[model samples]
Target: MIPQTDPKAGYLAQRAEIDAAIQRVLDGGRYILGEEVAAFEREFAAFADARHGIAVASGTDALILALRALDIGPGDCVITVSHTAVATVAAIELTGAQALLLDVDASYGLDPAQLEATLNAWPATAARPKAIIPVHLYGQAADMPAIAAIAEKHGLAILEDGSQAHGARLNGIGIGHWGKLSAYSLYPTKNLGAIGDGGIITTDDAALDARLRELREYGWRERYVSAISGMNSRLDPLQAAILRVKLTRLQVDTDRRRAIAARYDAGLADVKAISLPRTRPGAMPVYHQYVIETENREALRTKLSERGVSTLVHYPVPVHLQPAYLGRVPLGVGGLKRTEAAALRVISLPMFPQLSDAQVDQVIAAVRASV
Candidate 1:
């Protein structure tokens, strides 16, 4: 059976191309924010359909730096999903802003209805929320159209967490271009991942773009006189080079993911006791993780494991309950009821572009038997 995921298969497939990229970076001594990083930023910006792409140290820093660029700080609250990676919430806290935890819907993204309800029910006098950070959880784009409308109505900014979605799209717009700003993770596991930590922030706003360029660096456009207390987060040239190579193959890799997902859908749609993840019409998902929902999640996982099929939980705990965000105020509706329920019941199956059809069927058979 195909393991839950394998990052190396695809990397190994293009070992020679990847090696060349690495060697090129190594030979080029300018390591930080050098030509590779600058070129990648330009290419990534074009790919995302945004005016700018600011490279950074990691996805977490991308968010933190974005917040700092927007001047969101102490006493400011950021509305966001509590069912996301702890990084989403942690980044807000790092910027000294309060994280208002929101719930996710059955689609494994932000719940539009819940988001509206929470905004309506917010206790007045709470720190006037300056922004909303909706996570594109597990590679699915959050309901950006709805969220965008809500943010506009409430004057809240949008910062998308697009860590898992490199090629994911909604209504013809890529995930990174969906919100005012999107934070992308090139962590080794992401769809268009780098060999190591890397991140980019995409935005159409020129002013914000300029600010972030300064914000991600030493805040000095000119040779480090320090314009702000910006941290030392910069994308290394090697990661940028590698990611550029990876970026070129993203569409092809995403197509393979679609093929594998379709295989799973074909095999398991009628299977009892499990509900496959759904992709809404007008959206194209990259299938970063083919997660399934079922009440008997643990049992199914155990059975799959025993059968040599690897599985993973996208997230086992809702961000609100995490110690770091404990007692945080709720941002969107009832503080993650659906998220909590989904967390307990969901399990991600084997997924990768290079997975063979035989391997797909093996995983399907194992899952069916295990379930």
Candidate 2:
């Protein structure tokens, strides 16, 4: 069966280069926070058009450290959508803050209008609003311009969750352009993934960058001396070396993802039983999952599976409705109508840079027959 995603294929695509980089790291004998990590930080920062990059152990740690660096903790409330990986909300709570969940728009990003209305209606006794994390879900950017405007008006900080949007652009600007700081996950299936777990935070502000660097290494102004309370979340040198090689091919891989998305759009346009992924005007999405919505999602998924085409749900459950967070997480005024609806209908088709035109055509044919 055709797989929904293939991280192993990504490694095989550049096996020689990846193997050589691993050898170099092992030969150096300096594994943790070494030159490999530093070099990747510089290279990735330049790629993201940011002044600095702090490499971390995982994407969740990236978000937690960023919140800590921004001085957001205890009693502070962060606004973000529930239609995202639980990491986004969990990170905020990990930093000793409360997560105020919001809903998503048609593009599956945070709804900016809801944001404005929520801020206007916020009770005086509520926790003081501190930040907004607009997740670039499924490799598409949220409405940053509108979100930025609302954030500025309310004096709130914006920390973009760009884990799935490595090369995405909105109105010709990069994904991280509109936010104070941006965090990206380098998990194996992500657009610019490493061979193993890794994450990075980017920012234009020098002070924020310094604080991030310190926080990732136990708040060390000097070795073994804590300048402040912090945790250990340094990126592994092996993964850093692997990511350095992968980063070089990110744009090319993103272009291939877009090409596959275009193919899917054309092939599936006539299927009235399903809705294709929608792209916002002026946005360049990298199509991490190429999600399609259907009223009878389970039936369609089963049909596709029976035809030898594999599929997966981007998220089967919204974060707020999950066991740990149900009845505890706060929602925006109108509730998570769109977010909950999406959780039920969305299914990810096969998407990865290494997928050939033949595989894509097979998927389309299977979908057409099944749907």
Candidate 3:
């Protein structure tokens, strides 16, 4: 069966280059935070148009460190949407801050209007709102211009969760550049994935960059000194070396993903039973998942599976509705109406850079016939 995402295919596409990079790292003998990691950090920071990059052990660690670097912890409240990978909210709570969930617009991003309303009606006794994390879900950028304006007015810091949005842009500015600092997951299935678990944070502020470096490695101003409390979240040298090779072809891979998304868009446009993903004007999404919505999501998914085409739900349940968060997480005014509906209906079709044209056609036909 065709897989929903194929990281193995991505590696095989550049096996020789990736294997050589890995061998170089193995031969160096300096594994943790070594030359390979530093070089990969520099190259990734340059690609994101940022002043610095801090490589971390995983995407969740990236978010946790970014929050700590910003001085957001106990008694702080961070606003974000529940319709995202649990890592986003989990990271906030990990930093000892309360996560205030919000809703998303038709583009499946943080709803700016709800943000304003939520802030306006925030209870006087609640924790002071300190930051807003607008996740660039599914590689589509949230309304940054509007979100930024709101954050500025309310004195809240902006931390973009760009886990799925490597190379995505809005109004000519990269997604990670809009906020004070952004975090990206280099998990195997991500757009610019590494061979193993990895993550990176990017920022333009030099002082903040310095703090992040310390925070990720035992708060070390000097090795083993422990200037402040921190954790061990350094990116592995092996994954870093492999990512360096992958970074070389990120643009080409992103182009292929967009091409496949375009085919899906055109092929499925006429299927009245399903709704295609929407791209905001002036935004270029990398199409990490190419999600489609249908009220009869289960039946459609089963049909695709029976036909030998595999699909997966981007998220089967919104975080707030899950057992862990139910009746506890704070929601904005009017509740998460859009987020709740989207969770049940959204299904991600096969999406990856290595999908052949023939396979793309097969997926298109399968989806069309199923719908």
Scored against the true structure, residue 200 in model 3 reaches a CA lDDT of: 98
Error of 3 at 144 (Å): 0.4
The pairs that clash in candidate 2 are: none
Model 1 ranges off by over 4 Å: 329-331
Candidate 2 overall lDDT versus native? 0.94
Where model 3 places Cα greater than 4 Å from the true spot, the runs are: none
RMSD of 3: 0.8
Residues 112-150 of candidate 1 have per-residue lDDT tens digits of: 898788778777976567998888877788888988998
Candidate 3 residues 1-371, lDDT tens each? 99999999989999999999989988889989988899999999999999899999999999999999989998899999999999999999999999999999999999999999989887888666999999999999999999999999998999999999999999999998777899999999999998889999999999989999999999999987999899999999999999999999999999999999999988888989999999999999999989999999999999999988999998989999999989989999889999999998999999999898888889989988887
CA-only RMSD, every prediction: 1.4, 0.7, 0.8
lDDT of each: 0.84, 0.94, 0.94
